[model samples]
Target: MKIVADLRDRFGVEPILRVLGVAPSTFYDWLAREAEPGERELLDRGLLTEIVDVHDRSGATYGSPRVHATLRRRGIRVGRKRIERLMRAHGLQGAFLRRGWRGGSTKQNPKATPAPDLVDRDFTAPGPNRLWVADATRIVCGDGVLWMAAVRDVFSNRIVGWKTSDRCNTDLVLGAW
Candidate 1:
């Protein structure tokens, strides 16, 4: 339809309509119709305003499901699918909160005695196996969370050893070495 309108002045309506596979009478009838919002369109506009208001009031944390529930609580009956559709159409989205490490200390262990800085932060080693750095990280897998520990040689910057286990403990790091 937009193609027909844009090319109508250039190529004239008949040729454009024929090429677009649209009848000329149908196009003319559509063009002559009143340019007013239909009942459903007006309702959607009003609903969109309400949806935006609800989304803002919730600090943009409420998705379509929660928004639908909130509307229902306020005596505005609407489907969850409709709310989802409207939110998507208007480019509205909910906040996504990521889960981070929560339980143990992520820093150096305070209970254990601190080791002396022998290298003084200089990672360069005289030869292979002379200076090795060890670290562990948690990986999320399909079964569950798995802990991985790796030992890297500073001379070659290569991983000399690695171990994966279900538990993150001294044993895991020792096994890596």
Candidate 2:
């Protein structure tokens, strides 16, 4: 529309409007809108400014919901869908935690035999070392991830054996015991 306004003097209005596929009545209506802005247009324009500020302050991480919440906290009453519409029109978006689709991380070996459940869901033990349960966890370290494997004696309610390593696998668990 602005291009049509600027180049209309040089090339002419109808030619540019025809080339741009915009109706003459639509262009004239736009001119009238510029002359006297509608209430919704005025409100949307003001909201756009506030939305941009909130988005920028969040380092462009916040989406329409967060932006709307911030506006409401600051005593600005506006609908979330309206913020979404305005942000979409202006090409604004929140940062995504994950950019694209990814497959599951786990893969089981088809040929590997399953371990028998010796405990059979029962954890009670009358004496120490009669039964032990093990668990493994990974901790994010500065250099790398640390895998920790631990075994607990049910009777004593204490850790019987434990081990930590950079690599996590069956060997680490077996070695921990």
Candidate 3:
């Protein structure tokens, strides 16, 4: 009512307030208690510091979800949406990833000569030296990814001989054998 009287005496503000579904009195009341420029900047700076701190402490690994958790852990009350906004503003992000089972048995090639299935998936032997199964798996080492060919005794399921190389050449399997 006071705002309507004040606005009526000054510039026209009733139509705009009516369009926004808020009373002119309520809008003027909010304007009176609005945050100044300096206060808003200070709040933004503090929030940015918290965001950066959480990101660095996470070894740059935390996404918005984890960052939200970290903020709550430190007693900083924040919502996930707010954390996401802050992270976006700072250009901080987590690693990209694909979801699914990673590696599996390769489809048997019709053209290429197949290594005989000596064990026929039995994966069992009566004695230690009776059967040996071989397969190649990749491992990351100091210098680069190393392709390792290993032979395991079916009886004990223990890897007996293994060799690693930068390339998946026959030498790796032969050397392991």
Clashes of each: 0, 0, 0
Off by over 4 Å in 2: 99-177
**lDDT of candidate 3 over 4-105, digit per residue (tens):** 546755656777578658776786775564544467557767987998898887678789998888889889887898779878988999755568745543
Reference-based TM-score, model 2: 0.56
Tens-digit per-residue lDDT, 102-138, candidate 2: 6433577999999998988899999988999998888
Candidates ranked by TM-score: 2, 3, 1
lDDT of 1 by residue, 1-177 (tens): 766777888999998888878889888776765256678777888999999999999878899988999899888988889889999998998977568755553577779998898889998999998999999998966567899999999999999999999999999999999
What is the C-alpha local distance difference test score of candidate 1? Answer: 0.87
Candidate with better TM-score, 1 vs 3: 3
- For residue 31, what is the lDDT in candidate 2? 90
Name the best candidate (by lDDT).
2
Model 1 residue 5 CA deviation in Å: 51
Worst 10 residues of 1 by lDDT: 97-106
TM-scores across all candidates? 0.42, 0.56, 0.53
